[model samples]
Target: MQGHGYAQPLKRPPDTAVLIFLRVLFVVIGFTCIGFASWAMMLRLAIVTRKSLDWGLFVAVLAADVLSIVLLGSEPGDEIHTAGGYFGISLLLGTLVAATAYYLAADIRHFQRLRDAYRAQQPMAMPYGYAGPASPYTATTVPSSPAAPRSPLGPHTPPPMTHTPPPQPPVPAPPQRPAPARIDQVRAELDELSDYLRKHDGHHEGNYEGGR
Candidate 1:
């Protein structure tokens, strides 16, 4: 019992004084700051694969961690004497935070580009929420952009092209032509008119002489 008591007093407990913020950072940044790729994997957005993770950013993050350790004061009353050091820390943290946004946007655009290229190759593929393929007149030949807006007709159909019509001169109506009478009908009408005129000729002459 004496030996056990003496050993107990000499035993130093493991240091558990690490801050909660550091613990969270350890979980997020991982052991060697290679968690960016791992983060991509966990989120299922593939901005950086294991093979594609940027070593440049890795070095930068590693350097920032070192600088943060050297520049930051651990004690409650610790202070930085130089304004340059404060500016450096601020700039470093801001860049790191902005990196997250950059990766997010890159992942989304990469997904869009790959999907459009695939659909362009497969022409017949009509995926959900798919608009029609891009047009030839667009700046890009490949349907890389989200396809043109879908019309009521269907997603496969190209959007309607809007343009002004060319002006045209008004067309004048055609002139009406009189109908020709048959030769026999015309001869009969003329003979009838002549006989009627001969019958009324003597009466007409007598009225003219009386008037005179």
Candidate 2:
């Protein structure tokens, strides 16, 4: 009861202080990780694809991360007093930011180009909104030739067939022979009779000796 009564209000940090701290921390961490990832990606691309542009851009991004870290860690009065330090920081950070945007934009452009290429390679029979592989089931929208009839209602209809073709003659079956006399013949006949009775569309006789 005494502790609860005497409990003091929590001393929360100022909003500006928290915001500055978070902003610096997030930017520093984000740039560092992204820069390193870009560097590794560039290395892979260079080794595999032998793309000089990617390698160059990757180096630029990495330099940016280093510049940001240095600038963030500098003493309070160092940036103002040293002209060389100020110029170097400004150039490196600015270049890093610009290069990052440029490469990202380039990547988007390349992706769109690849998508367009893929679309071109697809079969023309496929409709615009189709989601599966090209097949007869896909809706086709190609223009028809002039020889093709527009519609039955608009164009002249074909003359109705005055005479219908005669129905096909019944197929002739080979003549069957009479069953041969054998020991299994009697059993087979009994089995056939039982099958017929089971399948017959008639009321079955009750197996009772007498009916009410």
- For lDDT, the strongest prediction is 2
Rate residue 14 of model 2 by lDDT: 35
| TM-score between candidate 2 and the true structure | 0.34
Summarize candidate 2's per-residue lDDT along 118-147 as a digit string, tens digits.
Answer: 666665886778788568776797997689
Q: Model 1 compared with the native: what TM-score?
A: 0.31
lDDT of 1 at 121: 57
RMSD of each: 25.6, 32.4
Stretches > 4 Å off in candidate 1: 1-53, 74-85, 123-212
The 10-residue segment of model 2 with minimum total lDDT is 36-45
Query: Over 4 Å off in model 2, which ranges?
Result: 1-50, 67-80, 126-212
lDDT of 1 by residue, 1-212 (tens): 44545422222322334333433443465324432322322233232323245545555555665565455544234566676557656755654555555544554455455556655655475889987867868746455666655589786777678887999999999997655666668889999999999989988999999999
lDDT of every predicted structure (CA atoms):
0.53, 0.56
Model 1 clashes, total count: 0
